[model samples]
Target: MNKIERIRELVEELNKAAIAYYKYDSPIMTDKQYDDLYDELTSLEKETGYILTGSPTQKVQGDVVDNLEKVDHKYPMLSSNKTKDLDVVRIFISDKDAIQSWKLDGLTVVVEYRNGELYKAVTRGNGTVGEDVTHTFKHCVNLPVRLRKPVDITFRGECVIPWDTFERINFELLEPYSHPRNLAAGTLRQLDANIAIERKLEYYVFDIVDGFDSGNLIGDYAYASDLDMPVVEHCAVRDLGEDFNKFNPENFRLPVDGLIYRYDDTEYGKTLGTTSHHPLNMLALKWQDQLYETTLTDIEWNTSKTGLINPVAIFEPVDLDGAITTRATLHNVSYIEDLELGIGDSIMVYRANMVIPKVHENLTKSNTWELPDKCPCCGGEVKIHNENGSKTLHCCNDGCQAKLLSRLTHYVSKNALNIDGFSEATIEKFMELGWLSSLSDIYTLQDHKNEMKVLDGFGNKSTEKLLTAIEKSKTTTLGRYLYGLSIPLIGRTASKSIGKYFKGDYSKFIEALENAFDFSQLEDFGDTMNMNIHRWYVKYSNVEDAYIPKLLEFDTPKFDSIVDNSSDLSGKVFVVTGSLEHYSNREDLVAVIESLGGKVSGSVSAKTSYLINNDSLSNSSKNKKAKEMDVPIIMEKEFLHLIGN
Candidate 1:
């Protein structure tokens, strides 16, 4: 096909893939293949000067960014709450020292107001940056579209798709979105803002990011209650002190995943910094969905790696966690036959992480079960393998689909390829498209550019981006790729150690592995791990033979940017005590110290840099700590200047 024709075809495929994967959770391409194909299509389009109308390359999933300019928020509303049950939330609230409340089910947005005029509105996209939805915001029902009174203000709020109206919608023109969150996200990004107006989305204001008088405002959250504007509810706590009423009139509306807690005093807020993922102020209470028991009637054997035979229980339908339970994965064949479980045995099952249930025991042991003599998937004859004299059934067929899925999962996990934008949906898509089987197929996606565009969400541009991402990934740290290869027990830390020893030279490592050299000779190499790695390389020789060449062809990632010292304030602790200025934000300052491996203290002690005062010099516990410890007090600017990032 000509380049233009090829580009057009690929875009169509990508569109289909996007729809199926995003909307249906059924996908047809692996992220790796998709990335490669996407890259090729983009190159083709650029070469042919032909971008299709239905191209994902031209748009971001049927939505286009607005023309409005971005305005920096004087205050950033870090995201909050991610739970569904009120019982757990109630328990958390009962235990918390203090709490605030608001609607949990709304699209969070930041609104900019200058001199009391509504100027702009932005939707929270990825927590850091947001989409400009000013025009759509004007059409939203709850927002006045114009201010009721004149005041210089820049505030944040949430716009939600209410459950009632959300359920009522049954339009022929609308997409059959599975949830309100999806519908709301799609609506806010509509090309015609008027279409968003038809959706009945509403807004509720909360934090004030910036305004003319914002600088002079005290940190009293209750004062916002009297400002004649909708404010999100939250209470400050001196401690998880004397458990206070966290739930008030303001608490019920939000559809929350969990509750949020912040130090009430601005001075206290400053002392607490952030972790890599969360701020020190908040503690998230995840609702644990545990497993419950049901009667087990039958057992099914599943063969896995290391030839361990697993027994699954067929049980009476019962509810455990959220979903109804019908089966539990029996860890081993011995586990099943050992239970003496029969056709009418009562059994117990439980779920952890709400993912899987385990068949613990048969309450009523009716009779024993027999082991299957044949492989379930391929009908291959099964053999009894004696592991340390304990017998387990093994299927000679090593290419079972279920087993492959589990193996592939390990290959693409966080420790492995570390391929960004790869989701389980994408993996299924790649397998369905017949573009992959073994790991090496990951390197050959560029040849299938024409097929990828036909899938949903892949356009010439997107495909190009994916391919770019893949190619960029070709040079990741050697440890990541090695870990990704599913080399048995070669964990991420071990792989890093090996990669550093070889300086990311996979060929040398592969060669050394092939020879079965004495690993005791290698420094810091454990005998068990060395033997394990060597055994893995030998057993998967065919795979290793193919993989090493691919590695040799790609660029290697380095560990050169290592920072070993937090020398600036090492052994000394620091607490943030008040509102920060001069530093870009709390995250930036914390990140700087953390990058150097320095520790940040949540509570004050003897070792502290000086409690930072954001509250125009307030006396707080952190301040007292600084005084008692003879720590030097500093401001945000001074810290920033000291660090000199």
Candidate 2:
């Protein structure tokens, strides 16, 4: 294809992607893939000077949704010139002191504050025009409703849902969001402010567009901070390469796509002028998703407890983000068909958010891969289920052995019964041997002690160890046992909430069930959750020899004393990062905090009372965020002292 022809194709493709991302809240491609194509189009446009009518290079991306009121931006909110190379950043800085901050991956909003109160908030719909989202923006948790000095101001910041909130929301969603950015955008664009409040959206001011006159980026941050507003974490950097090398996105609990470098002198930056699409004074250093090409070896379909047969792609093992990853979830049947995946086809994979391994693209689309006709575990008939345009495979047989195996596995999981030596593999082995089927069968394992001792990889000592662990697990709390039951819509947190209501008394919980209690009345419980509980009870109670809780002893539950003013840690929120020396693990530390009436959040925010990290001076993301929010960073000893340990 010639340059002009390629430009038209690129323009159409990129435009479609933008619509899918901004309008539909769905992404057709990864950010890195989009950036690469955009760069190619940019180079083509520059070389030929033949930019198409609707080329992405000619305008800012995103569209103002139909329901929102379109308002022209007071000043153009242009995109920034971006690069994936460190050399480009080095050139951009060129011995000038730069203010570096995270380029947060979320929807950008231009908020205006007048007479010390928030007047309006608008999205960066296009460079010149935007949708007014003031209603939803008012619900942002960290938004400064009333400025300290009652000064008229306009600032630009990101409206984001923290990674933890995103994951929690996604867990309950059938068609989960692709990323936090999508969720944030959807939440803010909603006409109802209640949606934004429930999602717990946050705002971090990055730039003072008007009202506040700060000489540099640092002063701008200080001005925003003085108003009790959360600001983006930043630092003065002389060496771009050093800071970039030290940056690790994984350390941050919030979603950040890259880093930004802005000239410290606001006046000097304005003097540099602007391009049609980007400002010359500010540059973005995008962290490209590193893709590894690997050949697909096989596809595995695993039967979930819900009888949903989820597809997992097994590829030639490749190292991604310092880990050897061989498998990535295909998500559903639609994803498989979309990629036209096939065994032996070359595929590109990357670590999403620097954590979950994901298949980015299929280089060789053979389209030979076929859906499984039978369930892998029980050889039962499988059916394809289409829900809300997404297709998934499910086992038709209700009594599939895989389902029972999954339930038993959950029962013995660490957060459930805390039973050691009963790995999923071991549980499956026992099920095949006709020694395990239901949760109650676990208590009867001692009856086959002799047989277990002689089994492969099992000796007299190992048998005794497993038996002892099983006996110890019998003394677990009601919350753990409830979670182990694997009821629909009842997660660990919900189970704990229910358990707390009954004061950890199994008899009291059973009484509530018998009396047809309205579980929705409980905190955080909804009609769906309440209905799920009743439905699960009806089915489980009818099962012959269903899990007998009487066989186990329930310990008294420890409720968090959040409202108790006596405890020093009460009402305090802590975020733990890095390695633990005083505690066994991060979970253990979190437990201690909870027991002392404190809450532990996954990310640092304005609400966080303290950030616990041994390396206080470390450049970890959590430390930077805490410093930015002015939250106290405490050593383990300091934390212990604060709690009067």
Q: Write the per-residue lDDT of candidate 1 for residues 24-131, one digit (tens) a residue.
A: 333343332344456677678788787765565554432113233323333444533234344535554454344443434446677776656677677654344455
Which ranges of candidate 2 are over 4 A from the true structure? 292-343, 350-645
In model 2, state the lDDT of residue 461: 95
Clashing pairs in 2: none
TM-score of every candidate: 0.45, 0.50
TM match of model 2 to true structure: 0.50
Candidate 2, residues 522-573, lDDT tens digits: the string is: 8657787899998877766655444332233333223222233244567998
Quote the lDDT for 602 in model 1: 47
C-alpha positional error of residue 474 in candidate 1 after TM-score superposition, expressed in Å = 12
Q: Give the C-alpha lDDT of model 1.
A: 0.56
